[model samples]
Target: MREVFQQELREVQDRLVEIAELVAISIDKATRAFNESDVSLAEEVIAEDPRIDQATVALDELAITILARQQPVARDLRIVVSALRISASLERMGDLSTHISQLARYRFPDKVVPKSLRSTFAEMGALDVEIANKLTSLLRSEDVQLAEEIRNEDDKVDALHLSVFDKVLGEKWKGEAVDTVDATLASRYHERFADHAVAIAKMVQYLATGDWDQSAA
Candidate 1:
């Protein structure tokens, strides 16, 4: 890669990292909005989503321009293509978080999510945070091993998602109606946010090892 192409690619990479960080914070805030029923926080998450969306679009355009002008090959090509796809996923994850936040407004603020399902949501929130941290680590360390570990890390979020469903249904089975269905739907959104982080990890792994794995889906 020429110096100019390398410089452009670096700029795209940095912008993508910015998008990831913003979306990660959005996910965290959205999860809290659901758990605590804080409409202000949910609204904030929704409001900030456009930042991620715009960043993704700008970064993608720059990347595409680089691909057209430079015609990079091998590692340089992988980095640009991977970053483009990663940015798209991050933007979608931001949208998912905003969707979750919107759902929390379906009911009154005083209403609490069922006690049986709260723990699972709490766990999912922590896992989402951890998954975000892991992606940050991958960027810093370029650790393929750590990136691969992210797939396993995502399973923890999946488990939490499943457990929330189980708890909600189990409570419903015990004659407790699901009055707060919003949180249940919100839990799935958080779970998908973690899933996007896993997609980034898979791309990171491919960047390092050139192995294609559809299992991240």
Candidate 2:
């Protein structure tokens, strides 16, 4: 029975890592769609979001089953609880990717980001994908240092988000109202995606150290 319970725990971890990978792909494709103004690619990203969501839901149910059947105690209990939280964070990250893709799709033919801000959005997208990949590593390895690194990457995303605002609101800004709205929403989605990655890393850190830090999330 003990071995079986342990196997279930391992399965949960594996599923979480799988979910992270899907989110990474979603963001990567979404970024490409946005950059190229490729409506088809954006549609693909949007269409696949349901897979991430369904996987997260299934993982949550499995975790809940383990909690009930195994009645996990101490560290085991922590693992189950944290798995649930991490799954939720991963799902939210996937949703953010979908949101970014939606912006690209909505603009169709024309670019969602104005030419002046394309480079900035491109950089933000790259950072988002980098942070997501790091998140997958952190989940699999549970390395606290990697968690810290993910947080640092999130800080870069935050800085980029602020820069977008500065550019849009600057006196030299010439974009139409739709352009301003699209840039703001797209930057926000990328920033929030990083935020979810950081949150998952914090959950992993708490699982490893048994020290929960709300501020980090």
Q: Model 2: per-residue lDDT, tens digit, 121-196?
A: 9999999999989988988899899999988988988999999999999998999999999999999999999988
The segments of candidate 2 whose C-alpha lies over 4 angstroms from its true place after superposition are none
Q: Please list the residue runs of candidate 1 whose C-alpha ends up more than 4 Å from where it truly belongs after superposition.
A: 171-180, 214-217
| lDDT (10s digit) by residue, model 1, range 167-186 | 66664544234444665666
Which window of 10 residues has the lowest lDDT sum in candidate 2?
A: 208-217
Best candidate (score: lDDT): 2
Instruction: State how far residue 125 of model 1 sits from its true place (Å).
Output: 1.0
Instruction: Quote the lDDT for 109 in model 2.
Output: 91
Model 2 lDDT, full chain set: 0.92
Compared with the true structure, all predictions reach lDDT values of 0.78, 0.92
